[model samples]
Target: MSDAQNTESPASENPLSAWSGRTDGDAPEHLRWHQVVRVAEDAAHNDADRAGTALIGFASDEGVRRNHGRVGASAGPAALRGALSSLALLEGTGALVDAGDVAVRLGDDETPGDLEDGQAELGRHISGLLDEHRLVVVLGGGHETAYASYLGLAGSGRVGPNTRVGILNLDAHFDLREAPLPSSGTPFLQIARDEAAAGRTFSYAVVGVSEANNTRVLFDTARELGVRWMTDETCQTADVTNVRRFVRDFVQDVDVLYLTIDLDVLPASVAPGVSAPAGFGVPYEVIHACVSEATESGKLALADAVELNPGLDVDGRTAKAAARLIHTIVSRHRAG
Candidate 1:
């Protein structure tokens, strides 16, 4: 990636200008994320320990368009940041660093940018950030963000042929589609193939799958690949004992974990602003429990929340939900 593509520089205007909220006080306890966040460039120059959360934005919807889904998820990063900015901060939440965005620029003729190149660029940035920050949270463009996230982990020098890495996806659909090219619906399968080529084990699990949404062939493919999953109906029970156990077992079995949240996993009534809202989705409490369980495991290295289409949002409800999940992932994350 070129230096021109990296917008995290301090000399540039603050990319987090969206991070504005009421100022309660100058003290740490009174501060919100906006008051505490610094640009990546600023963080690098400072003497403070780089032991906090680093946020990067993937501003591309090319994958979603290719998957024949709604096209507005490209704007998810800014919307998430806006939602997160005003949230109250706790004493030990650690420093927040905004690493700016890896954006897909449009051509003069208005054609879409290359999704493959954008994912590759995002991987390079994520790999670099993994070395400096305790936790790296990618604010996403679409489900394709997960594949780029996988690239970052593969290149971070932490995983090898023998290392067991787990991927936990929270979504209403199984994104294991067969396609001529990569798209929002094909990332997990791409990861599986990539892992196989590298002689690594592909440990993947999905929660909140909608049986009616995914075809039988997809289910057969998932089973053939040894993917573990729980349906939306299964996750809707008031008790989360099974959910906790499912996440706990996955976390225990892998040396490292990557958690990805697709907002469509939640009921459409709860999260209407997604490329494809769920007709029968997992409840918010169940999803929250899953995230909390994963982050508390100490093996979580990277996490992302994707598929928030601001154009379809109802009063920013989806953004708020996504932000809440992100907040939990960052605040509770323990580096492996």
Candidate 2:
């Protein structure tokens, strides 16, 4: 299906149409009709107190495949917004803003500067949103923004030993491969490699890997970096708390953490709508459990839910699951 077909239908002619009313019931106003921002102005202005959390959604065409299949992942940001609207506001104490997608350049023979420029844009916007000390949740144009988020947050002089922020990732592929420069799939690797080069090493604990399917090179890289991992074998029988504890101890030096969730970690049975669905994966509860614990730990600076291409979803199952995960994340923060 086309990206347009996947997006939620426009507001209907119901009474709530004119105003941001709840025609669909009790869903929040911000979640409905959140326009896709192609520029920075729309993402820059926001009242810190009024906005509980700021999550800017956007995508990059790099690593995007044509077949018209997962390449439609560019539609992920919009698809997720449709699912997040009207969600149970959990504790009813927070606000989320859809700061539109970060404008990016796409196509073959794309210049490396394009990726750098996109990261620069993301860094500027994320820094602007962090002005309030509010947790910045970037909903992702792609996983590459993790580098920009770290660079911008670190550059602002806010990232330090107290935050004890570490990275918690759930992905099928380790994405540990690096290029002479960075690209969409190489963000985390660049983040760690670059930071360590700057004498600021980052600790990342990952879960839900598929050793059977991953390349030997990826495994070697993770091992070399001392990254703690919980592959498919472990995810099959481990409790969510186990993974959370790994994060709690690994990230003792920073004050806030950065969590990146790549939907490929889920088994095809659960997260079927992603760009790369694997066979055996963690249950959805694991995601919520991890989110709850991390937020309760008081060091979650930013959390990202990536790779949800609802255009390929069946019955909105995966989309709803992602929305619920974000809800619990917000709820946990409110509880603290």
Candidate 3:
């Protein structure tokens, strides 16, 4: 195993620090996320059948560097954890476990580790966690988190060639760049290729696409790959009935779902800390409604919130928005 696969202990260099929040009485009704959170290492001896949400961090933005975007998204996971720490834990959310992180190690020369290797390590860890938790939510480094999330679900043995796996990406870009190497812009393309190679059906849909941001060729590529998408303008102006129909149709077509949220999909005013902020993006209520639709379908197996660049955030707006979406996901999810 590579050094990245060696999960760090909270006592050591684990980024999951003391999750401090408001003090409520010892009763479960007053609990918040920080209060109920347990370290994966500490719970290693616990029952495997215990139902809970497993949170893993992918602390590498090498893909963003390769794609020539902002570089600070590597800190996304920690920022997300900090944002989630104080949130109220609703009843039925069940147990929440901190599974440390799958981080890109720095070499002696200070260069970042290989992105592909780190993704593989993340996949292995996520696959193992699936057996223990009902939901596995990966806090990400970039949109590259989607490919690694796919890897985990593919390796988990819960889905096979015959299973229809749906991928719902909420982002400003289609992320289908044909790059020689894997980058944040190339994860979905890589996933399509992998599905083709393995003879598995690829069911992918993207909401909140920006026509001004993506090239014509990218649209052509998405069309050629049979991708389903709705433009940002459509999402922004469409009525709730139309949006719900779109999401519900996609959710009904697949047996399992992997939902990925790229923070750039939201308006810049709401989420300015992403590598690419949206000038005209989907409204927060629209995004939240979509997330609720997916989770309530009982098909959501894995999910992630990516591209939260704390370095660019203004008063933690991006993290807070992402955390709210995550809160909605966890609260509504019906784990299978």
Query: What's the number of clashes in each of the models?
Result: 0, 13, 0
Candidate 2's C-alpha runs over 4 A off are 1-51, 65-69, 110-113, 160-164, 251-253, 334-336
| RMSD to true structure for each model, in Å | 2.7, 6.4, 2.7
Q: What are the Cα lDDT values of the candidates?
A: 0.85, 0.62, 0.84
**Best-to-worst lDDT order:** 1, 3, 2
**Per-residue CA lDDT of candidate 1, range 171-286, in tens?**
98889999987889999999999999999888999999999999999999999999999999899766588998999998898998899999999999989999998888999999
Residues 155-216 of candidate 2 have per-residue lDDT tens digits of 55456543344788877767776655565567768777766866765677787778886689
**C-alpha displacement of 290 in model 1, angstroms?**
0.4
Off by over 4 Å in 1: 1-13, 44-49, 106-112
Can you write out model 3's per-residue Cα lDDT over 1-336, one digit (the tens) per residue? 124645332212444474677868679888889888887656545554247788888887788887889878878988998999989999889778877777765322245457787888888778877767778899988888888899999988667878898999999999999987788999999999999988987799998999999999999999999999988888864565677779999999998899999999999999999998899999998898888988999989899999999999999999999999998888777765
Candidate 2 similarity to native, TM-score: 0.80
Q: Quantify how close model 2 is to the true structure by its C-alpha RMSD in Å.
A: 6.4
TM-scores for candidates 1 onward, in order = 0.94, 0.80, 0.93
Over 4 Å off in model 3, which ranges? 1-18, 44-49, 105-112
Candidate 3: pairs in clash: none
